[model samples]
Target: MTLPPIRFTADEAWALAAALAAADACAPYAGAARTAYQKIAASMTGPVSVAARELAARIVALPSRTDAAVRAAVEEALTGNKALRLSSVDAEGRESDRVVEPAGLLTADGRWYLIAWCRTRRAGRGFRLDRITAAAPTGERAQPHDLAGLLLGSVAAGAARPVALAALAPPS
Candidate 1:
């Protein structure tokens, strides 16, 4: 079924507004995107159906119970003066050095990523920090773009294609 555009009830509108305000006041991080979208969508007068409201509610509610330490780390990574040299193995199994100016840290689908401007790639790219063996301050830094400036929207996560997993019968 096709998802409808988000519409909000009075409570939803108020909640969303508060969420956006909190997000703005808190820090520039990836956790706030859903809330930000909800707040903005709530204010609009349109046909926000039950499905849309449910989706918005899920997004708004996702951030409430995260660990404090992880959250702090994200805030620091986004706003701190640090250039992390990320190492990755490409599809060709080649090691690469990606010098990036981290703008934010995004956690989605149980994965953490450093959203930064890749100096080598000469564009904005999301680097999975788990693959990074080293992250040290270069002592030289670049100005970070504002959250909205680097607004990737849905592009940050690529398209998902279905994959099958096979299970074998136990050996006798």
Candidate 2:
């Protein structure tokens, strides 16, 4: 079946607004977000649909949930369906490189994570933004991966909340 655009309830919309506000990583895209929101908002009057409201909030705070250039490159790769090379330091403080198919950016507890299909590891991985030292597009095409599925499987230690997971996902 074809996927329909996801909709948010009133509470979800409010949560998204709060999430966006706390998304300091995405602050650089404020102008773009406002422009996009304005364009979307222009179509409706007075009150908006829950989906539109949620979308406006998400758009305003989407992209660059970390270092602007690194996160921007990753987001560009995701939008273009291209592979990206990332240099990051793990918890061990050792640096490693990976070519990943970009999926989405997620923020939980004020920390940002880049969810992706890692060619180096041959699996899904979440790289913390602060640990990523460099990121650039590889020019190679990327295969599509289920963003939600990757997120579901990646969250561990029972630290992630369902509200965060739901608020961060892009429309299907």
Candidate 3:
């Protein structure tokens, strides 16, 4: 389906650039969005007669996603229902069918992780969403534990930290 091009004001583009720098996976999308906005700023004819060269300068710089496959993959993963389950390949080359009560999604160190409650283990687990082979919700809801609170007051805190740090952060 063909969609109309997006339009953005100069101010909007500048604001978007600032926001994109702080964002993780969406940075590429932000760049594309900014480009559309810049085009609008140039052709805009009204009382505001801005310089053309300065228009580009106001744009927020972001990592470009030239690969169609990568862009599609990222779009598919992030758009639509954030609550939906996803299937992807994992690190060990094993298919992991997990019923996760997804709490939040995080991208750290260039990898996307789902912070969810794993039904099989009956615990809060961080799954590398990209590695998931397949994901489908069971229509069954599981109680999510406040892992942060539990770990803060338990021995698990020590274990979660590095060995060197764990020794210093032992359970009180």
Which segments of model 2 are wrong by more than 4 Å? 1-20, 26-31, 34-65, 156-172
In candidate 3, how many Å is residue 61 off? 10
By the lDDT metric, which is better: model 1 or model 2?
2
Task: Specify the highest-lDDT model's number.
Answer: 2
Query: What tens digits encode model 1's per-residue C-alpha lDDT throughout 1-172?
Result: 4455655676766565454544522233535665556556654764544444555445533343333343444345556656656566554667777677777666555555567777897777775544554455555666665433454564655422212111342221
All models: lDDT? 0.54, 0.68, 0.48
Give the per-residue lDDT digits (tens) of candidate 3, residues 1-172.
4446555565755454444444433333544655654555555554332433354456444443224343333344334323335454556676666555665444455544555665676666666644554554444444544545433443334334334345775483
Write down the TM-score for model 2.
0.60
lDDT of 2 by residue, 1-172 (tens): 4334555455555554454454455443434555544443444433445555655455534445356787678777877889999999999999998899987666666566778899988888898877788999999999988766676644542434455356675555
Candidate 3: C-alpha lDDT = 0.48
Give the best candidate by TM-score.
Answer: 2
Ranked by TM-score from best down, the candidates are: 2, 3, 1
Clashing residue pairs in candidate 3 are: 86-135, 87-132, 87-133, 87-134, 87-135, 88-131, 88-132, 88-133, 89-131, 90-131
Greater-lDDT candidate between 2 and 3: 2
Better of 2 and 3 by TM-score: 2
TM-score of each: 0.42, 0.60, 0.43
Clash counts for all predictions: 1, 0, 10
Model 3, stretches more than 4 Å misplaced?
1-15, 21-88, 147-172
